[model samples]
Target: MTGATYDALVIGSGPNGLVAANLLADAGWSVLVLEAQPDAGGAVRSSHELADGFVHDTFSAFYPFARASPVMLGLDLERHGLTWSHPPAVQGHPFPDGSWALLHRDRGITADLAERAHPGDGEAWLRLCADWDAIGPALIDALLTPFPPVRGGLGVLTRLRHVGGVDFVRTLLSPALTMLDGRLGGEALRTLVAGNAGHADIPLDAAGSGMLGLLLTMMGQTVGFPAPQGGAGELSTAMVRRLESLGGEVRCDAEVVAVETHRGRATGVRLRSGERYAARRAVVADVGVEALYRHLLDPSDVPARVVRGLDRFEMDPATVKVDWALDGPIPWASAPEHAPGTLHLAASRAEMAGATAQVASGYVPAHPFMLAGQMTTADPTRSPAGTEAVWAYTHVPQQTRGDAAASGPGGTGGTVGGDWGPDDRERFADRMQARFEELAPGFGSLVRARRVLGPRELEQRNANLVGGAVGAGTSQLHQMLLFRPVPGQWGRAETGVAGLYLGSAAAHPGGGVHGAPGSNAARAALAHARVSALTALPRSVGRSVRGTLGRGTAGGGAS
Candidate 1:
């Protein structure tokens, strides 16, 4: 290996990759990052091409987890030119009738709004809020840390022990409908709460769906949905700046082709263009698990059990995103009190559940739940004066089996294409626009320009986002914890192969812009490098083991 090569090579320039590079560089290791795209920030980026002076988030818009992440906080992103802005109200759900339920940052105000909608809902909101407030931090800790959550798991257990884990788990077991029914009375209020819970691919009736509502609500109250100051890309820009400041280098347009190994140990990587970069310390992959195991490493290099575990990989629902340059603020029947936060366009809990169920069953919902955001409302720089940059996204079944005709003219039903071709993109966008028109009349007229990206487009842009599954993988219970990626692979970011580590959303503490996986991987690489210095002693011990337990067992155990 050449000494000119870096000590650490991060194979993706996503948030996780940047974080890992920063950590390694900060620890005095020469780090390099290779990005397949022309720029950094895999999914966290913004562009003004949708309309002049109108900046729109290319992908993820809201940053609930980003604000609360300890890793993000520790970086003091604000100092790195990151600023957060929130709307007056966190979110709102508008109904056909002249009624709207809003989520205010203030619990009291939100409770009062719930009360106005339904008498006892105020108390229920307060109780749920309080319960979440107690466990929210612990949950974040458990999530942001590596899996097994040994420390975080212990903390959660300690907190829930007195309350009883069974009871706590049971409390979160009820479907969103059941929970909302027990808590709120009005249809609008129920829709407001349950719609937020349906952000993931999980059906509202799914076992762990309730936690989505609780966690998102608590996070919204705590940090509000915020966007970067200049644009979504600014967040990524800040990360890149920090990594560079720490002596890290990022090479864009460099796609990793394979993980090079020597003597059953990962040694470096080969780029698609045939360029090779050796890792003196570690090779951190910020790509999807499927890409990592199936494409990058040789099958013989990966354990057979790990390969079988890939079958259990459950992806979140596919998403259809629409970005529009609005002539003005959305024309709601009853003007919402706050600058538009996230708008939920559903009326009842059952309606929202049915919509989610429809999507889960490979059918487009007649009344799809839409999450609309006015980006410029939160950050004025997003659009020209008197105009708003808005976006809406909804999840659909991954591989819906049907024809476009079956779904009618403007439906999503078709042989699930690998890429959301231009035709399907336009159709999905039109369907969403029609939905908005029904919920808020004349909404279509306000659009100055429109752009759409379906699951396939999203995946093409960012290989890390396989199948356009944004939440990395399914955030459900079975795929979470020790079972994340695979069991017995917790704590250490490295796989069984030396010098190779999983540092993407596919790893534990999955998804969001948290950067925990990258940080964790960097720490593991540093430890491994330190341990390498004492290899002489280990070699002597290895000789004794070989003499005692025959050559087969001795070299086999080491391997």
Candidate 2:
């Protein structure tokens, strides 16, 4: 059966796709969003499979980016039954000495904690915050918007002189470790910043790492890492609700096998079920770049340069995530003053760097650094009272060559094979659990149940997560901005095919829950539609003029 034609057809109902559909609908365009999965929201989903009463976010949990993104905020999701919830603190890093590095929502409390750790660090922390206060908003605006960020970049430049100008730029460009070493002597502040940098696959010692680390840290300081009041799915639900309210439609379990095109333009898509849906104006894809070019579109439709660019495209790394339904809160030897929603587990800075290096070198680190979330703590509605819904994820090599834990840094001669089979997965989960056990004694005892999702499982659940590489692609300097997805494109949402746009994480201003990629694509579609209509006006008039002249000549001859 053939599906009804819409002004635009959006592939994938992830946050990006939903955002695009909402924008198109706002412009009075008929938009339909298709999702291959059984449910909508993509990675922004949740389930109670681990425990009857516990709600666990399937993929991404804490959303500091969503709280800070103007694109997300402008949607007014709160009106669509979405409420933001923040834990007592934003992020925490527990040390072996029982000292904790916690980022509190209040800058004063965070500074006080830093001061307690190091004499001069309190003032240093505030100084950095003040500088961020001066330019962070503008910088973030520049980051979350389309490339060249003229308005936001100008906002940044106008405020630069007040915030160390060239030195500020240097600080943003510096390596994460180098920035921390130069600015603060306290391990607490350093740990917080460095651990946040781990959220990305960038190495701590790399050039572009500082900006990401600082961006997240500063965001936590200001907006805080918030979660939807119920679950991460609520965020997606809110987006879908908003889109539906705007007259957009979403259909799940509809797998698109191919994007049908003709005359170098996207026309519609064909589903595996032999159904064809026409898109009158545009087709926005919220899938990975590789999936769009390789699987969806025909080879003849893809530009040769893009085909070549795909060869150089590098995925970040594979991942392994574990979820637990804890009977009670994590019992810490020395509890943080304010419980944090998110925590970073690593013995030290060196160990954290070692783990990332191991992954980059195609080995699974023995002492993997983990980014964990206390979902119940972040949003009390996630689970029953007095219980916790916790989850953690660590990066691994896309194709494991060895296990570094057996002999790598901080390794205690543990042997876990690189195959990532059931045995290997269990062993690695045990290894990660041990890290928590170190900080919270008898932490394993509180687990009511546990579930693990490795690379294979992740890919099975979400095709965009190819090999469990969550960021869509590497967030390195070499693949960002104009170089993103491919060079010569200059971070545009438009694919080479007219009326097609890449609205996924693989596009510019990559990753995070920010809606820039989708918004960019939607705007591009609208712009092109206008241009096409305007360009067609003269031709339409010329034909009409010729017809009128012919009719007049015939009438005169007959007379």
Candidate 3:
């Protein structure tokens, strides 16, 4: 492997890396993807280690973004043996009163449910869905494309006026709860939106929260939050298989320790085992922003602006995820007509916001707002018959200050240690379980086994999940779009090094299983190669002219 060379060397085997590799391979480039982990997928991997028969996604599960992404869709992964499965309902939020707020793929059904929950809300839901239908594709295209999305922007601009133009923009800029309040009447509908917004580390009252909330819920309504039919790993496996079929290669257990650069340009990468592989065209990195800049590349290779920007770079909050293998289906006190694959554990918009605020303020929320998944409900292949595989995750501060859930749940006090040690993780898991038990009376009895992955454990599994900051970096407005990874880069894949590109979640559009970053990076590399090829003739001609003149001068001197 040390003497090997390829047209492109992708420095991770996550979705983004694989996407980039596949695209390059399609372009007839010799692509090689090097993965540090024993397995290929980064956060996209799954395992059955938690229990005997239940399959669990180690990191990310549902992929509404992937379904809606042009890059993923264009891959035709279904042909490569990847299939998606969705629950009867896309998502659901249960209330203390036994009523539920559910988002179904069918707009009419979702609207009817909303209307039943609150008068006029049904109409409002339809209007919202209709508006999204008008602008959503262009909006998504604009988002997934590189900065200054000319074509996608034009598409969005053409449709903006019909969607209330500036007014719609203002609505997106407003806080999520505020937007929901103005648009819909019922708490149930608002709760559904707010809960989706809470998926990010953004505060419910923040400006960007509305856009995220709307984007996710609208995506659910359109595509549904679908997962791989067998497991999340299957998504990655299909990508790898597709890439391999395209004459690409993926090397596992190949940790890239340093990016080899020459004269301010990336030339290749060096592994931890002292092996080096060269990249003839470009080296695409699918690692974290900080890890790439601060660790992989040398200081001289990185731009001063990017290095200085790192000082202000903030990561999203750490997370604690709990996975459970259940003996039977989750015993909801009042199940919905259509079972939902995803569930939100929050009482209301206010409760969700308060919990988010608590985490932001360096304290664990007593009643944490959690996003949970019922894997078996979505795909029965995840577990044995009559059983379920479930997981829930919530945010925690990078550093612990105190526990705010003193008397909240699981009979634990507010003084659980903040270090996330064994004791701390157990206590927090108990708290999360208690939250689940609140909505489902017999939840504990159904749990056959459980696994708690704290920040450290998560980071250990995937270095890109720095401190368990799943989104790679904060999705806040301060660090998004032009400001993501750094301000000078203009949200492009180029890392300011001549032949290196950032294809990770840290790039523009932040996180999610979408392959935009990878596609963008691969396209950028291809564009650069085309430009280089186009200019080669002139450069060679000039060199020939110079050589002829030099030879003439030497001949005259000899005479």
Candidate 4:
């Protein structure tokens, strides 16, 4: 606990923490990962919470981001016992008329299906997918790296050309609905895009929302929605296995209470049990910006600009997730065969628009836009034979304080209190199930067991999911890249403190199971260390002289 030193310290065992630890360990650094949970994986872990043998991811499930993650890929988790599964279909948007707009791994088939629904849309889909294919790699490189994504950003511009670049810029700024309008023929295609975009707390009419749906849809088409063969926890197991192999250690049930710093430089961390670990190089925190600034570090050590930025550090919408151990698959009225991919079930585009508006204004969407994942459909290892591990999550206001005026479901005018008690959660969950029942008849009958996790419950599960804002923070214009967590170049780790780095989702490349934040943090830490080492020439010389004097006196230290 005392007088011990490690080359690097990671404050959480979430994906970000594990990734940062792995990266540092790869660099031949002695790293220690501390986790408050009895296990690792943060929100990305899975468990048999729903039923016996039916594995359900406790929080973050889908692996679209992880599938494309450079960090995950470089780590080669697959070689460490992580197997992936991809369903035939990537996504589906069904309607009441027993028709589905599905996206497949095969671009031609997906476009063809779209055309059948809306003839011209088939060509449009292919064009869009092709555009993504061309610039997608560059976009990923630009997005997943540190601020000032020069190469990736330029690659996109060069591919799009002048007029296309302007158009793409407009799309990034336009509301998702606006972008979908007149572009696609069928309601199914429109719903498909909206579903992808609305996965966030953004309103359909909200500016800067169009790109979200477009990017996700395209990613689904290209990389696809793949999950681990066993369960999400397997990803964690693989990561830990890899980390340990690099001489990195992860201590579960080790809660880091406060980061101990001296002279504006992080020295180490103190555990809740009063055990302290001294860090020789740097400390990385994989917690929210709010928690990091308000709790962990001493307020006196904080910079004023960061304090001001905290006011603008917005959290995304809260969520209420439901997981079920179904007796069988959901008996969908349309495209029951699409049980493998993600399903979007909302009444209609207009209804979804109204619902999202309500959520943006801090009220729950009465008919919440739901993203349902058929886990067993994609990976049979998730549940017992003939049964399904079904899970769905939808956005809601981060309303938890007290009652406020709110229009419930579909943004209907009504009062909605801010408080979210067990009763409130249950009521909303029941309504969501009922909504699903409308799309898939007998859905309730297949549910052998169910678990509901609301905003508070999510926070209890993982502090990084602060206020149940799962994606770490909002992806709005003001909270993005160069301005994330805090203003200036401060977003990429190097939290105002010299040796403390913010490796959490609140940092750059916010949220998802992607480990870019951690990757960036590791790079920053290494850079800082190199800079410090160069600056410590005189100090090192003094240390060498002091060691020479003490060599013989410190017996065991002398050869």
* lDDT at 244, model 3: 96
* Clash pairs, model 3 backbone: 366-405
Comparison by lDDT, 1 against 2, better one = 2
TM-score of each: 0.90, 0.95, 0.95, 0.92
Q: Give each prediction's root-mean-square deviation over alpha carbons.
A: 5.0, 6.9, 6.5, 6.5
Candidate 4 residue lDDT tens string, 149-240: 65667777787663267776676677888786766777777788877888876667778678788878878888898888888898889999
Better of 2 and 3 by lDDT: 3
Best-matching candidate per lDDT: 3
Report the error of model 2 at residue 224, Å: 0.5
Ten consecutive residues with minimal summed lDDT in candidate 3? 550-559
What are the Cα lDDT values of the candidates? Answer: 0.77, 0.89, 0.89, 0.80
Clashes of 4: 9
Q: How far is candidate 1 from the true structure (C-alpha RMSD, Å)?
A: 5.0
> How big is the positional error of residue 319 in model 1, measured in Å on the Cα after superposition?
1.9
Writing each residue's lDDT as its tens digit, candidate 2 over 52-104 gives 87899999998888988888888999999999999999999999999899999
Candidate 4 clash pair list: 366-409, 402-418, 403-417, 403-418, 404-417, 406-414, 406-415, 406-416, 407-414
